[model samples]
Target: MGVIYLVRHGQAPMHAYSTDPVPADAPGLTDLGVEQARRTGLELARQVPAFTAAVSGGLARQVATCAGVLAAFGEVHDGPLPEHVVDPGWDEYLIPALPGGPTPDMYRSPAAYQQVLDAALLRWTAGAADSDETYAEYQERTSAAVDRAVELAGSGQTVLAVSSAGTITALIARLWGVPAQAWPTLARAMVNASYTKLLVGRRGITVVSMNEHAHLSAADVGLATFR
Candidate 1:
């Protein structure tokens, strides 16, 4: 048996002209985003002992968040715990065909953009969208990555993985057996840098907690942006 901690990346830069056509792999974290990661890392260090290992999506934000958290742990332990492993399978689902890319002027309001993104996410998760990564493909990749992390944890070891809201939501939906159409509810409620804990045993993975953010104060509780 092992425990797996799935953490969503810290806030990202959200601005009118923020959307750049960079490869999904290289989007950088914003200043506030870095602060969010640092706060999350500090909190986790105070709560958890040494984990077996840590993993993260290769995205810059994910990697930065993982590093921030690890650095916090080092502040106490004063030593590196373990090297981080990068797995693209754990990356967020990308909807290249979405009506418009991430930009300020595309949608009249944040609510409208969210609605459009949500619909696209639902369609992507339900295998109704055509993209480089389908919903089914995402499921297989993320699930496999989690299973592998569990295997690596073995016993008496915790595995921490930093991912995105979409990936985390998809995993939760799979765990709760929720349909793709209901993902909007999950996405809407997911918080940046929030965490979900899972315990994996012979039977399977059991969710111990979802979207835990006790470490964050009320002021920290809100949508975080870098730009």
Candidate 2:
């Protein structure tokens, strides 16, 4: 058996919604986000010392987080960081745009955006999403990515995969047989730069931990944001 670690990318710049058409998949990490990734890497290096390899999702934020964490690990540990690659299969489920391109200012509160996101998910699950992929498609992609990660890990090797909140949570939900309705709620709780661990055995993957961020101290509270 081997271990697979799924990491949520650090906080991104431009988290607030903008009326202007944001470039798809363009956002990367903020300064604080970079530090978060670095801290996470140092923590992981302390915990797991060695990994077979690492992989990252296609998004800039995900790849940047992967690089930051691995770089920090290399600096703290004796060996150079292993080469990592990008796989779009671990990309987050893209929520369809609302009928009107509404900005955060359009909503009464940030929580209201969750309603919009849920509505978008309803459409996605129904195969009526505006984006190229439906929710079902997202499940398929993320599941495949995880299977590939397990294969990459091989016998007793620990491998890491950096991805978005949706991808990480979806994989956990699917692995643990959590109900579909519970997915979004679980995803919402995933802290940025946090990680979930699983033991990949001949039978299948088994969860060791989920959405852990113990490296972030009380003083790092500002870096412990969800958005």
Candidate 3:
């Protein structure tokens, strides 16, 4: 038997300008985001002795969170941590790609971008967003990530993966056999840096915890946003 920990990345920069697309390879975390990751790492260290492997999405925030977690585990060598892997499929649900129009530089304003993002998130969660990836495709990708984590955990190992709240919530919805349209209600309660534990064995994968945040103080939990 093995355990897999699905961890959502910590708080991120909520600047109104955040709607601007970051270079695919260079997204960075904000100061508060770093603190969130550090606190999450401390919590994980208290709960689990060591992870057999740590994985994350290719996103900068995911990798940054992994770094914080490794440092907390006292494995801060100057090189790569052991068994770190990245998969694009583990990335957050893509915001609907904007079509040909004014470049980002020509957008209405920061506040306007934030409003658009808020509405888009709502439509996405409500299953009303016409996405490049169909709803079925979205579910399949998330399921594959969970299945891959289970497969990688072979035996007597614990795997930890850092991703986004949306990714984690999508997986949870599948695990609970909930309808996709219910994701908004499902995701609304998720806390950043919180983790859910799943046990995989011969019978099947079992959910041990969902959105566990016992390691964090109340102040360190919940969403942080810039309005």
Candidate 4:
């Protein structure tokens, strides 16, 4: 038996949808986002003192989150941490190509932006993807990543896998037998720095927990973000 923890990266400095050109690659974490990751690490270390290894997507947010979690682990536990692996396959699904996308800083209501995103997500998951990376491709790569993580846990070792909300929810949705139409909802609701724990053994990928974010308290004004 082994455990694989999936962590959604902290809130990015800028969101791809909100930012113009949306940045071709990874973006750094904001100050508050960094605190969120640190809290996650501290809380997580309390839950699992010893992790066999840590892994993350190649994105900057994911990489930073992995480091935060490990650093917090070291703070709570007195031992050397395991190696960290970077896998690009675990990255989030690309946004669909829009014929006339909104300009950067166009400034619109959140509702309007969500409307566009919802429509795009529906098409993407339906195989009518408007971009180079289809929803199916996203699922395929994420599933492969999780499968490899489980196989490589090396007999009961615990592993931490940090990635974007889309990738984390896609894997959990598969394990929980969720339909495609409702999958994006899960991703949208996930808080930055939250995690889902999966137990791997004969049963194979059982969900011990999902969307755990107790580290972010209600008193904190701007901590529980789902961007």
Q: Residue 193, candidate 4: how far off, in angstroms?
A: 0.3
For all candidates, the clash counts are 3, 0, 0, 0
**What TM-score against the true fold does each predicted structure earn?**
0.85, 0.88, 0.77, 0.88
Could you give candidate 1's per-residue lDDT for residues 1-227 as a string of tens digits? 78888888887654312444666555467666677777777777777777779999977778888887788777776555888889887877653453333345544476766766776765665566556766677778988987778887787678889988878887888888988888768867777777888888878889999887766646655544311
Worst 10 residues of 3 by lDDT: 98-107
RMSD of model 2 against the true structure: 3.0
lDDT of 1: 0.73
User: What do the candidate models score in CA lDDT, each in turn?
Assistant: 0.73, 0.79, 0.68, 0.78
- State residue 17's C-alpha deviation in candidate 2, in Å: 7.2
Cα lDDT of model 3 by residue, 82-147, tens digit: 567887678776544422212344234645654565456555555553566655676788778878
List, residue by residue over 1-227, the lDDT tens digit for candidate 2: 89988889998775424435666665578888898899889889888878788999887789999999998888888875678889999877654343322355534464876777766665555566566676677788888888889899888898989999878888878877887777778888888899898888888888999988877645645567676
- Give the lDDT ranking, best first: 2, 4, 1, 3
**Which regions in candidate 4 have their CA more than 4 angstroms from the true location?**
15-27, 96-109, 220-222
Best by TM-score: 4
Model 4, span 15-118: residue lDDT tens: 54443444555555877778888888888888886998889998778888888888888888998998888988787765435323333343245555556666
Please estimate how well model 2 matches the true structure, expressed as its whole-model Cα lDDT. 0.79
Evaluation by TM-score, superior candidate among 1 and 2:
2
Best by lDDT: 2
Candidate number with the higher TM-score (1 or 4): 4
Candidate 3 residue runs with Cα over 4 Å from true position = 15-27, 75-81, 96-130, 219-227
